[model samples]
Target: MHWIKTLKYYLKSLGPGFIIASVVLGPGSITVSSRIGSEHGYAFLWVILLAAISMVIYTSMGSRFGVSNKDSILQSIAGNYGRWFSAVIGIAAFLAASSFQFGNNLGVGIAMEGITGVDERVWPLIFTPLAIVLLFWAKNLYKLLEKLMMVLVMVMIVAFFFNLVLTKPDVGEIAKGFVPSSFSFDSLDIIAALVGTTFVLHGALYQSYLAQKRGWKVGDIKKGLSDSYTGISLLALISVLIIITSASALYPNGITVNSAADMALQLEALFGSYAKVIFSIGLCSAAFSSLMVNAVMGGGLLADGLGLGSTMDEKMPKIFTTIALLMGMLIAVFFRGNIIYTLILAQASSILAVPLIAIGMFLILNNKKVMGKLKNNLWQNVLAVFGFLLISIMVYFMYGKIITYIQSLS
Candidate 1:
């Protein structure tokens, strides 16, 4: 009974971190991690650890800000910098979410097509409306989202772990994957995508807003930190499991996964039809979970940017959320064949917003006026600097890749 009470208390404190984890573990992460595992085996596994550490640091900062203040991070920016700075951050966050929606919709379509044999394009049309309904009509939006994301996280963990067990991966290779190694051009691209997807700026910013929605206060700082750690650690674990599964199952066979369907086929070949179904379910959960959260982030932030209400219940935000979803679905439908490139491009584009958001949050968090005793300590400041440099490196590589892609197109 005592343990049960403790469990209930723990569960009550967890919300924002899981939301960030769910959004980060979306279709983009699945597809990229699977592709990396299939192509490079465990060679780049170190990247996941690096990305997870960065996630914990930045997300903790966001959570601290949320608990330290009564206002949203956007409002804090407005107070410290200027309204224009806040607006820019909000708008940029919205655009980044919109870009990510493309991958989210494509992932949903692929998972549906893989499962039901319907046209992939049709699935997006069906799922988008369902997402809209959940966003606008749910009785308690925050509770619903929290429960839903927790379930999805569980589904991903079990499904991927089952597949990993079946793969019977080499223990020695798995151990070596944790060791840092040199990278090739292609590996560098995958690394950038991994960083972009895992340590998401919008997801980081949304953490503060989410904590506020969950009614956390300065007294709850320790709980918030625990939630952030639990969420990102789960994220890193699931990611590594996917890579291990793919490495054991696909890498050994020289099977390159260009789409979720390709991953399904390979899983079928390695672990029978049941594995394929499980992987598809996990993929759909990932895609759908991300679809809803990304829309919320994009719409909510856009609403805030335009001086509309920032909360999820606001009509303007809901409207913009729908627009973000529809725009992503349209892109996914028209450009189905290029989804691999589309996912990569979308993840890369997120680099544009990372430094801006990170720097703003850093400044705001360090401001004694805003944060009081919670103002970043020396170690937190050091980590923030490291996070900034990490974002800069990702941006540099992403820029080079995008330019190369454009030149190839021309």
Candidate 2:
């Protein structure tokens, strides 16, 4: 009975972290990791490890900020910096989320088409209304979302792990891939996208808002940290599994994956039809989870910025979230060309907001007036400085790639 109670308590504590995990493992993750494995054959696997570590550090900071202060992150920024700064962050985050939503909706469509043999474009029409109903009518929106995301995470884990086992990747090469073997300029764009998607600005900032929604106090700081670690660890593990499955099944056969569907086709060739179906199931879970949460993040932040309420129960946030969902579905249904390029472009555009958000988070967390005793220590500050520099470098590379892509188009 004691063990059962403990298990229930632990599951209750996992709400925010698992939601973050679900958001991180979107269709963007599948596309990037699959392409990395198929094109570079696990040589770039180290990037996921780096991204995971960076995510843990920043997410922990966000968790601490949530527990240590009563104000929302944007409110804190407004108090410290100006309201304009807060508004900019909020608007930028909303726009970035909107841009990524195109891919999320596209992912949902692709998964549905693959699994049901229906037209890919029809999925956006079906799922968008379903998502809206859940967002509006779910009595306890946060708990309902947490529960739904938890189930999806489990589905993705089991499906990917099953496929990973079937792939039977070379254990020795997998071990070696962990080491930073070599770097390729061609891989830089995907690397940035991986980092951008994994260590998401909105996702990290929303950690504070989520913790508050869960009613976590400063006393729960340790628990919040544990939850963050657990979520990010799962994210890294699932990502590695994806790369392993793709590397083993596609690389050896010279299969080039241009989309998630391409990856599914390649997996079918290697492990028969069941593998493709399972992978598509995983893809659907990822896409749907992200589609829901991405809209919430965009709409919630924009409402908060506009001096309306930030929580999902508020009128403005719900309206804006619905708008985001519809916008994404429209794009996914109508704009059918060069989605991979669009995904990369949207992911890259998000880098413009990262440094600003990261720097703001660092400043707010370190503000003794805000965090008081919970303010970052010297080592934390050092690591955050390092993270800022890392984001700067990524931004440079991402800008170069976008320009190169544009020149090619012209």
Candidate 3:
């Protein structure tokens, strides 16, 4: 009976990290890691490590604020910035995130078609309804779903590492990725995509909301922190693994892969056409899981903005799910012509948001009035400021490239 109790307790402790990992494993991660592998080989693996450390710091702040104070970072921000400013941020985030989800969903579908040789256009039609159903199935039921995604993560790890071991990637070159090197136009973009990912708001926001949803209390702070750290660590490991697998197989071959599907095709050479099958299995899990999280986050944000947090009913989840799914599909259908634009928006959202969110949290955490004795110490402040600085630099450089690219086209 004691053993059973322990097992149940451990299982319950797993949710927060599972949620964070699910969002982190989505399209941005898949493509960026694959590109890093194909372009720089194992040389970019360290970027994921650095980015993971940043995400750990980022998610921890969200988890701490919610569990300790029983209020969200957004709520704190609203109090500081005024309700109107907070409302504007929410609206902009919703539109931007919705647009980004479209790209993520379409990327998943395209990868599925590439793996299965089916029509890409038809894939979204099938997935749209499925995604909606999964999102609203039950808030409590996400535990089981999280467990399933954990299994999927394991499978992906095995599939990737197995191939990586067979190739015997150069450890020496992989180590070189950690040391800062001269940046070129291409290297800067890949680094931006790598580190820019840490700034994305969805994963951290999910951490905040999930901590609140789980009834985690001030007493649960240590547990919440441990769970969040685990999740972010797993996410970081997956990020590094994706880069290592891609770099080992694609870079030496001089192969160029511009999309997830292209990466899948290239992986076929390493793991066989069955690599596509494995990738789709992973992609579907990633896409649907992230979709469910975004649906919940967006809907909750909408409800919170309207002061209707408690008014959300059983139907609210389903309605929000439908809204998100439809919005994503519409973007897929209408904006299919410009993949670059969609990709830029998806990556840029996080890059632009991270610094602001970081600054806000630093203020909130250090407020001796708000946190009292629980405020961040000097080391935490230093790390947070450094992370903010790193993300700001990446954003500045990436924005330049985007402008240059646009000018060339004009």
Q: Count of backbone clashes for each model?
A: 0, 0, 1
Instruction: Report each candidate's C-alpha RMSD, comma-separated, in the order given.
Output: 1.5, 1.7, 3.3
Q: How far is candidate 2 from the true structure (C-alpha RMSD, Å)?
A: 1.7
Off by over 4 Å in 3: 1-11, 136-148, 182-186, 305-321, 338-345, 402-410
lDDT of 1 by residue, 1-410 (tens): 99999999998788778888888888888888888889889988898888888889889988998887888888878877898888888888888888788889888988888788898889888999899889889988888999999999889889889889999999999999989874676566777887876888778888888888878899999999999999999889988998888888899789998866788889998778998899999999889999998899888987876677788877898898889988988888787357687686777667776688888888998899999998899998988788788888888878877778768777
In the range 1-410, model 3's lDDT, one tens digit per residue, is 99999888876687778777875566656776776678777666666667777778767877877787766666766776666645554554454356457656777677667667787767777778776666555455455556766675566566556656655777888778766573566676677788754445546755766787778888888888988888887777767766777777788889866767777777777768777677666666666666656555666555554344522234554465478778877777566355644464466545654455556667777877667666788887887787778778886876676677668668
Model 2's TM-score against the true structure: 0.96
- Candidate 2 wrongly placed segments (more than 4 Å): 1-5, 184-186, 404-410
Top TM-score prediction, candidate number: 1
Model 3: pairs clashing at backbone N, Cα or C within 3 Å? 37-247
Per-residue lDDT for 94-201 in model 2, tens only?
Answer: 886887788889899889888999999999999999999998999988988999999999899999999999988899999889898666776677678767767777
The lDDT values for all models are 0.85, 0.85, 0.67
Point out where model 1 deviates above 4 Å: 184-186
- Deviation (Å) of 33 in candidate 1: 0.4
Compute the lDDT of residue 21 as modeled in candidate 2: 90
- In terms of lDDT, the poorest run of 10 residues in model 2 is 344-353
